[model samples]
Structure formats: structure tokens, C-alpha cells
Target: MMYHHLSDAMLDDYLRDVPVPVGLVARLKQTAVPNDAELDELLRSPPMPDGLVDRLQAAIQDEILDESLRQTKVPEKLLVRLRTIPRARRRSAWRRFAVAASLLVVLFSAYCGSLSALLAAMRPKQNRDTTLTIIELYVDPTHSSLLTMSEADPTTIRFAPPTSAEMAELPIELARLDLTPALGPAGHLLQEVRRGAPLTEDVFLMRRNTLGSPQTNDQALPELSHVRRRQIAGVDLPLAPGYDRAFFLKSGIHPPVFPAAGQPTEAIQVPLVTRTDSVDLTRRLLLEGRTPSPSDIRVEDYIAAVRYGLQASNDQSLVLYATAGPSIFGRQPHHMLHLGVKAPRVQTATSTHMSIVVDVSASMRGDDRIGAVHRAFEIVLRHLGPNDSLSFVAVNHEIVRQVDFLPASGAAQLASMIRDLDPSGGDNLAKGFQAAMSLAFEAEVAAGSARHVVLITDGQAAIGDRDAARMRDLVATGETFSIRSTFLQLDRLISAETVPSSTGLEHASAVSPRQLPWRLVTLATGQSPVVARQARLQVAFNPQAVLAYRLFGRGPTAVTGLADVGVETDLHSGEEASALFELWLRPNGTEDVGWAEVHWTDPATGSPLTTERMSIGRSDIAVSDDETLWPLRAVAIVSEVGQRLSGIGDFELLNGRRFSQRKKPAGWKDVLEQAVGVHPSAGEQSDFQQMVDLIRQLEELALRGPK
Candidate 1:
């Protein structure tokens, strides 16, 4: 078929009432007929039309259908009616051209609505001066607190310290600190405060008594019911000798709602390790024919539970890849942004000295918790190479026994000793931790080895420390010596929160018999070699290009009474982290949508930090069939499952409007098709499908249940 350039006469005929040949519409749809450069240049000009290709395609299809019907024989009445219709006369070329130009203006104006929206969205607004909103993750090593602050808001939100009763709810370490002097009579420490520069939502407060000797201040501080607000320049206090303080305001991980035009930037701190206890619990509940509580489902854990097979950076720099696509869970105009980050891979030169604390308390006997520990140890033994050393400490209401560090050659003896362990009596966890720390401290100093203390328990008893201060001192002493610790809960029979959070532990996990091996392996690999410490990923969306955005999973919500947030999340060698965001792009916006950056302290240097960044633009958008998008597809599927199970209804952005609604059956079908058919089953895709199926069954049962 021959195709020609769209001439002025052709455009005039199409714009006018004059009937044009059916072939003209088809020719316009041809790629060779219209010069893309010419069309794009025209679109770039003022009053240029958008969606020209779509309009042409639609017009061509309609004309083809009309011509096919015209080929068929018509009834006598229809033929007579057609003949009776008025025959329009063709106008002169100049007159026709004049009319076509007017019509073209109207069409261009219609398309420019989207263009105007794009420009308006990008235009700077009054009072919102910053082009970037960076939420940096700050970890105070001295106070052991993880602080995430948004550098967008100037207003400082202040809340009074926890009262006497509220203080009891604080972690053991923080609860023991005497703050009466600092808080004063009405907790009015920072009076006559003033607002300074813009600050992010500061979400944590941590304090420590740095004095060599304890100070006796018997002043009483009254309890207040409500939180007092003050626009303070910063967290400042006239401190007594040897007392240090830090404070920040708090907010949920994702705000209840957001407007694209109002808050175009969305960010979250990427988790270094995968957490699966919540995912495991939800699956267990479904298997037992019971619905899991919404609170029990952590979206971050679910998504993290599925390994995306992302590789680590080969060099010292962090690796970051970002891409966006049409959202599957959300309606039209909503897009999903996927970010995959990897820390640099580091090689370990020294061996690790591990102090394994076992809780042989009778409570562990109920679920064969001891057996789970044995299985976990078996996996640990496999990962322990010739350079590694291990020790065992038993605790039952008190310290039962302690075994000094043994080389990897003693694995057989260690396994034998572990198998011989028996559950009895209760547990004094504080004492157990002390003994394990002592062993680790000794080993670290003697051999200059990596010191790690692993505590395995059923989390059924409290440390027999009435003062609380003593236990805090003990844990702080271990931290002072740079002893790393991890808590492994043998069972979740009790609330997982009961496990001590103030013990300076890197991570706490509940292990089932089936998950014991995998969890241990994950832990082992995660502890392989330290690559980056205090690592954080920050993404800033271009307000002009991106209208609004929201993130999936609880990225960084504040937990009251907790000093640190994700303090234990250090990037291990070859570990990958992922995040998903729902984005609404401005129509006809610039290709420069946003950018991502990662900052972390290099473990080797430990002084000056390192940073790497990548630009996200229109070209970064990927189609469903793109093989490189599997990780993102996997993240999306896992995140959707989490949102559905958690009862946080799916977020939808239609046109420019945003809302939340329960996902429909069709939505699930689309997710399942992508998960099973399109996305590769490289990681936990199969298990994810099972989770999807289970959620469907539960939904079906829910609809059949009482309202």
C-alpha cells in the first residue's frame, strides 16, 4: 500500500463535512505516512495536540467499519432515505483550508488541557520553597536510637517525656534512667522555645546518663495527660552534669492520606534483612482455618519475606535501580515505582566468635522449642567455617552452665553438647545475657574476632531485676564493648513484643520448626561480612513531574518507648533491599520524574560516609514483558498480598482523583496472572502464589460469613 504525507487538502477534507475516501483514514494511521519528527515538533509548538496517534487509530477503525457496512445491500426504504438526504457541495480549496485551520485550533486546545495540567503541576507554589525533601536516617551510636527525619517541615512538634506510669511501659534500658531532674516539676525542660529552620518529622527521643558516678536527685515530676506542643528550634535542654538527651517527633510510616499535587515526594528507609515471622503467622492462621488479625500482618515483612534475587554491588558504591509502570492494583493514571538497592560486597578477613545463649526453661518444652534450637544450631554449624569459634551458655531461672569458645573443629562436640541439652525450671534472661556477653567479650579481646551473641528462648519470663537499672547497665556494658547480639524466639506462644527490645540486640525473630533452618541460614548469610552501616535509601520525586505518591508496607512508622528504629538494619554483603511506591505522573510532564540516592558509612573507614545516586526519568519506565522487571513485579505482587491481608484497602488513583477501596476479583486475577504466568519464579514466587490463593479462599469465606 502506498502512503503519502498528510497534505493540507487532506486535513481540510477530514475536518470539513466533505466526505473523504476511506483509504485516507487508514493511510494516516500508517507509520510511514506521518513524519514522527514533524508531528513531535508540531506537538511541541503552542496549541499542539496530544493523543494524535490514539485519535487517528480510533478514526481509522470507525471508518473501516462504516465502509464495510456500506458494501452490503441496503433495504429500499434505507436507500430512499439516503438518496433524500441533502448532498453537500465541496467548497473552494482556500475556504476549506481556512475552516480546517479553525477546527485544528479547537482540537489542539482540547489536547492542551492535559498539557496545561502538566505545566500547572510542575509550577512552583507559594511557601513550598524546597525542590527536594530528603529524609535521612540518623543513628545515634551513643544513645542507641534510630532517627528518621523529614527535611521538609519547619514546625517542631514536641511531646512531654513518658510519666511515672508511662515510663514503666518503656524498655528496660530506658525505664531505669532517672529523668526527674531533667523533666522537672511539670516536665517543662525546654521553656521559651523558638522555631528555627525547616526540619523533618523527628520521630525519636533517647537519653543516657554519661556520668561516671550516679547523681541523687529526688525531685518529683508530675504526670501530664496531654502532650504539649512547642515550636522549638531544636531539642535543647539545660542538662545536669553527665546527662545527655536527644528528641524527635513521631508519625506513622505512611500518612493516612496524601495529595499528589500537595506532597509529590515520598520516601522510606529500605530494610536490610527480611522479616518473615509476621508472614509465617498469617500463613499459620489461614492453615488453621482462622482469619489472621489485620494488625498481625506487616506489609514490609511480607514483601521482604520474598527474596527478589537482586545482586549486591561489586564495587564500593551502592547499586540502585528504579523503574515505573502502570499499577495493577490501582486504577488508570496510577503508576508503580519500584526501587532495588544493593550494598557493596565486602570480604571478611577474620573469623566470628559466637556465644549461643540457650533458654532451657520448661516453657520451651511445650512446642519442642528445644528441638527447634537444635535444628537451628545444626544449620549454624554448617555455616561456621574453620575460622569460626562458638560457645554455649544455658539459662534456667539462673545460669546453669557456660562453655568457653571452641574452634570449628569442635563442631561434633558442640552438636553433641547441644543435643544433650534439656528444658527445665524457669529462666533469668538478664543473667543469661550477661554470661553470654562475658564469653563473647573475652573471645573478641583475646582473638580480635567478630563477637556475636545469639539468644534462643521461648520469651516466657522476665529478668529477675527489680531495679531495672542494673539490667540496663549490664546490656550497656556489652554494647560499650561492641558486642553484637540477636534474639531468636523459639516460639510465638506469647506476644513477640514481650521479648526484650532494650537488650541492644540487632534483630529478634520467632522460629518455628519448619522455619528454623531457613531462618538460621538467612541469619548466617546476613552476618557474613559487614559492608555498610547505618545505610539509608532516599528518593525524592519531582513535584512538577510527579503529582502525588504513596509507599507500600510500613516503611518507617514510629514505635513509642523505642529509642531506635531499624538500628539493627545494617547492609550485609550481597544483600538486596526493595521498595514500591504508587505514583501519579503529571500529563505531558518532563521526562525527569525523580531521583534516588543511597548513603551509608563504609565499615572499613567508619569515619567519612559514601553516597551513590541514580536518576529516574521517562526512559526508566518498563513494560510488563520486560524481563528485568521481575524483581519489581515480585515486589508488587507481594506488596499487594500484604495490603489485602492487612486490610489496608488498595489505593486507587483515577484520572487525578485518589481513593481507597477493597480489591475486586478481577484485580486478584490480574495479580495472579502476572505472578504465575509473566514474572519468573526465581525467588518465593510459588509461595507467594499460595499466599494469593489462601487470601482468595479467606475472602470467599468472608463473603459467605455473617455481616
Candidate 2:
């Protein structure tokens, strides 16, 4: 029988009183002992700190208790042996110190491995690893109240000296980074941060969720969580940027207070915009193992992102759908009214002239923004026919590349052009738009071919035409040539006036990269035609039937008797636009709840076509579980989740001095069980499910103090 050979260390152990096999005995003869010179050199080294072995062993013991450490695949037997090493060896001081130093190195390497695992697990599955520079602020030990910023990755980050306001408390000096040439315009972002702008929440959360220190559990937040933020101040202390009202208001300016009893009729001007960014932002935050900021939750966007089973119209008119159900939300029982409208489908067989302008600026480098633009055009290219013409333009500081009116037959060439896009330099989106419009007019449209310019950008126009007036002018020029402009906003924040006065039926939609292909398909193929231009919905609640009412998604800019505000919204074929209202119903009142009106115009004649109205009745209200009431139930479910995260519309009796918990709303479990949920079964359904689950998990995590 053959015996396995032992290692040198094991052989040393075996030779000390233990019997060794013949195979190990032969290997032991080859092993060498420390020479006289090596022994002297080891002795000459400086003495180790007193209790160094004990401290390291204690640290390892505490590290084992961390959640990250518990989840790691470290060998239990090895850890147990390491813990007992000091007691097992009755050795000299220098030898114990040497052993402990070696163990410290091993522990550090293990920690790095665990940290990489933790970050990888938090990143989205579809995204590649992105390099990010994190700037951390820690309280100085000598001066507990003072904070200091650490040096970030030198290539990507830079800091100017603190401004007078920033140094009010202490200098808080930070090391200035040397920004490389490749960083380009990104270097300005650090100045924005130093000026008290809110830093990206991802950076903040990434640091907050990293592995705990091995030496101590002295974290900034209260309680003793294994995942702790060492850079944060105390519990009541504000963030480093000093969050103000403007910072919170960026989420959205709260709508005017709900109309009081005996008030005039309320009307909301539904703007022509698609609000999907907030939903995308909230989901991305949750996917990264971070609780979304309350301000990031916009209930209106959640309502707009999903479908409500609205069907297409047969004629050139509006199809109105309305439903009423008793709501389970709020301090008092209320009624939920769901108002929906769908525009009739228009078949356009004419060839389309398409112009695609892509932003290849430095700010668009992260988050795969350029990749999304590429994918959008790929979808558009697939939808076009041989006769259809395509124009591709890329912009950064100046026009990077422009291929004018490439026939669909040359799609391979266009694809190659788009794939070569690389993000760099400044953003001059206005120049790109001008070039695209010039190309569109230079080529005469064949008889009835449609003209469309699709501008894909993150909306950070740094160099030129940053104001609304210039963009409005560009939109007007596009209107002259009957060119429809569609701005695909790819950022988390959507400005209210991306293309200010879009009278020429210009459109804007906030969408994620994953959603870009489908959105582009709808635009490129005219799958959903615009049946209504400058359309608006007016819902007047009966004062006798309802004591107070609040409109979800949009709040009335002003409330007067009637016709107070004028807003234009575009209604598309096979697309559903819905508004949810929470009405405080008056007991012992009339049966009539409210009435809604849909006003729209003809797409060709620019004349008002017809008005549609539906009268809501209180007597026909059903419970949420009713199969026929799914549309209204969906509005309730999505609105409630948004309110729970945002704390908006919740009554605060004590005005922020005290807090209390009321009964939670019901039917979430039932909603999940229903076949029809927030998104369809294709790919979005799974994402919606994951988002809901993450919300629940985050709520539980909040309740369980620090773990």
C-alpha cells in the first residue's frame, strides 16, 4: 500500500514524538532547518506590540460573527485550530508574534475575497463591472466633531479647497486628486459634490453595505449591525451635503393639499410625458441591496409604467374607461376612481424617414447609456423596410459621425457605425439636433413618407443650448418640415421641460436601457399612432358626494371654478393613460360620485373632434377582490406601495414631533396571487415581482434594528 507524503510543517510535527511512515521519512530528509544567519536575522527584528497575538485572535473571533463572515465558505476546523494556536503552543514571545503576523495576512486576504463577493452579489445581473471612485469622510480621532475627506481614485476624482460655507465648522481638508486627460468633463462633477450637491445614492449605499472592519465595531449608526457605515455621522446628524428642501423637492414638489369640502371643481392638466424613470430608479436601488430614498418614490410613475388592459379604438375617436371601488388605504375609508382613455389606431403604410442622434458625452459613460442608444437603433433598423431611409449622427462637443439618409438596405453599414460609438468629451446636443434636422430637410421626402428625428440622450447638455428656448426653437424647425421629435431620456432625473413648448406633437419618454428596444419599436413602426393631440382629462367631483379628493400621478397646478389650467397630453392607440383619485366620500349623500371628460383634437386638421364623458356612481362600488374590479384594484395596490415608501399624503397629526403606526392596508398578497399584476409575463413581470419582494425585505430589515 502507498502512503501519501506529508508537507514539511506536518513532517516537523510527525518527527516530534509521532511515528512517521517510510514515505514521509524520505521527504523529511530533504527538508532543511533555519541556518544560523536566518535565526540571528529573525531575532534582530523589532519586538512585536504587547498582546498583539491576543488582539488579533480576539478580532478574528468577532469577525466570525459578522453576517458576511457567516455566509463565507471558510473552513470551520481551520478557524478552530487558529483560535487555539496560542494556548496550544507554549512557545517564546518572538515565535508567537511571528505566527500571529502570518495569520493576520491570511485573514486580510480572506476579507478581500469576501468583499468582492459582496459587491458582485449586489450589482445588477445585466450590468458589467463599472469602476467607481468613492470619497469617504471620517471623524478625526483627535477632534471628534471635525470630519475629513479621504483621497479618491486619482484618475477619476478631484477636489478643490473647501468653500467658505463648507469650512464653517472645520476645514475638512481633502487631498486634491490629479484628474487624467481621459476623465475630461467628468472632473467637474466633484466640484458639484463639494458645493453641497447630493451625491449619487449608489455610492453612498455601496460604502454603507461593505464588510465591517475586523478591528472594531465602532460604526456611525446606532445599534450593532454587522454591515455598518464607518463614514457616517451620528443618528441625528444630517448627511455631509446638508440635505435641504430643494434636495427633497427634486423628487417632486408635493401637489396642492386635497380640495376641501364646498371648494370649487378641481382640474389637472395631464402633461404629455411618460414617467418611467422613478420606477426604474426605485427598482435599481432595491436590486443593489439598498433601500430607496423616500423622495425617489413617485406614485404617478408607478401607475404609468404598467398596463390596465385598455383596448384600441376602432374609429378616429377616444375610448374612455372608468371604474370605482372602495379603497382600503388612509386613516378613513375612501373611494378610488380609476379614469382611463385609449386613442384609436391609425394605420400609416407610408415609408418613414428616420434620424437618430446619439449623445456620446463623458457623462453618458457609466450605466451603459451608450449601449442603450446602440440597442435602440438596432431595434429601429430591424423595423424599417428597403424604401425607408435612416440618418445616424453621434454628438460630443461636435458632431462625431454623421451618416445621412442611409437606405435600409445598407443596415449593415449603419450597424457598424453605431457599434463604434465611444463616450467622451463635452455634450453639444443642440448641434447634433441641428445637423439631424438639416439632413432631414436636405433629402426630399417621397410623396407621403413621414419625417421623424429620435434624439437619444441623458439630457445633460453641457456646452450649448442648455436652456428651454433654444430647444423649443429646434422643435419648431422640426415642426416646419412635419418632423416628429421624440426625446428618449435615459437619466434618473427628468426635467419638467426637456423640450419646453412641444406644440408640433413632440414627445418625451423616460425609459431604462432594457426597455429601450420595445419603446423604439413602437416609435419606429408607428405601432401605436397618436389619435389625440393636446388632449386633457377633466374630472369634477360632486361636492355633496365627496368631502375631499386627491388626484394621483398629477396634481392640479391651480384650482378654480372651471377651465383654470390648460395642459396638453397626447393619447396613443393601444396605449392606456390612467388617473387614480382617492375621494373622501360624504356619508348620507347623493349616489352620484363624480364625472370625467376627455377632450382631444384631430391629428391632421388640428381641430377639436369630440368630447367623451362618463358619470361615476357610488352605489355600484365593489370590493378590491371582485374580478371585474381589477383595474381599480391595481391603482390602489400601486398607489399604496408608493405612499408607504414616500410617506406622502399620510396625515401627520403632531407635525413631525411624534410618530405612530396605523393599521396596514390589505390585499397585497391577493394582488400577487392574481394572474394580472403590475407587468406582463415576458420579462417585466419578473422584475416587478423582484421589486415588490425587495420592498418587503427592506421593510423587514428596517424593523429589525441593527443585526
Q: Relative to the true structure, how large is the alpha-carbon lDDT of every model?
A: 0.59, 0.59
Candidate 1 lDDT by residue in tens digits, 435-516: 8877877783345556777777765655444524555665667677767667777553432333444333436666545455
Q: Tell how far residue 248 is off in model 1, in angstroms.
A: 20
| Residues 105-182, model 2: lDDT tens digits | 999999999999999999976523233333446833333232333233223322233332342222333578888675
Alpha-carbon shift of residue 232 in model 2 (angstroms):
35
Strongest candidate by TM-score: 1
Looking at model 2, which ten-residue stretch has the lowest summed lDDT? 229-238
Name model 2 segments beyond 4 Å from true: 1-263, 266-273, 350-523, 526-530, 553-566, 572-574, 649-707
lDDT of 2: 0.59
Q: How badly does each model clash, as a count of residue pairs?
A: 9, 0
Q: Give the clashing residue pairs of candidate 1, or none.
A: 122-544, 146-564, 150-200, 154-198, 202-249, 260-547, 260-548, 397-426, 397-427
Q: Residue 383 of candidate 2: its Cα lDDT?
A: 63
**Least accurate 10 contiguous residues by lDDT in model 1:** 228-237
